[model samples]
Target: MATKVKRARKANFSDRECVKLLDIVDANIGKLTNNNNTLRANAGKKAVWKMAAQELSAMSLVQRDEEDCRKKWRVSSLIGPTVTL
Candidate 1:
């Protein structure tokens, strides 16, 4: 008899979660570009961010806030006005 094997399913991230993941990638990229030595010092983090960015791109979940401002504004319109303290 052949043995049965189960594969683990990948978790799906919501749009908000995707945004947070991209934020982490952007932060790591910023650190790498801010200084020459930072790239070497943060090699592990750089690799992690690079992989994350690629994954996000592949999933078509990465978006720029400025570029998607119109879409965002339209969505926010349904929320009514924001109150400032």
Candidate 2:
């Protein structure tokens, strides 16, 4: 018998949550925005993201992990704010 695989729950960030996440990211921009390919730089980026997740979880009702925060940041940056004419 094959075991069923469980999928992770989706994260929906509110406007306030998004603002908080951006604030955290901005504070750690030096570490998070580095483009170095070295292992140390990659580790630093990971640490920063993890810290951001913790900060978000503490400030809000929703609990977010490092991967969740990372994915949300990517999607947010890509789509950005939409303006309707």
Top candidate when judged by lDDT against the true structure: 2
Can you tell me which runs of candidate 2 are displaced by over 4 Å? Answer: 1-11, 82-85
Q: What does candidate 2's lDDT look like per residue over 8-76, in tens digits?
A: 765577777788778888788888888897999999999988888898898788888999889888887
lDDT by residue (tens digit), candidate 1, 1-85: 9998989544444565446454554555555345556546667645655555455556564433322332333354467423222
Question: What TM-score do all the candidates reach, one by one?
Answer: 0.35, 0.76
Best by TM-score: 2
- Model 1, C-alpha of 56: deviation from truth (Å): 14
lDDT of 1 at 10: 40
Q: List the residue pairs that clash in candidate 1.
A: none
**What lDDT, from 0 to 1, does candidate 1 have?**
0.49
Candidate 2 backbone clash number: 0
lDDT (Cα atoms) of all candidates against the true structure: 0.49, 0.82
Off by over 4 Å in 1: 32-85
Q: Output the worst ten-in-a-row residue range by lDDT, candidate 1.
A: 64-73
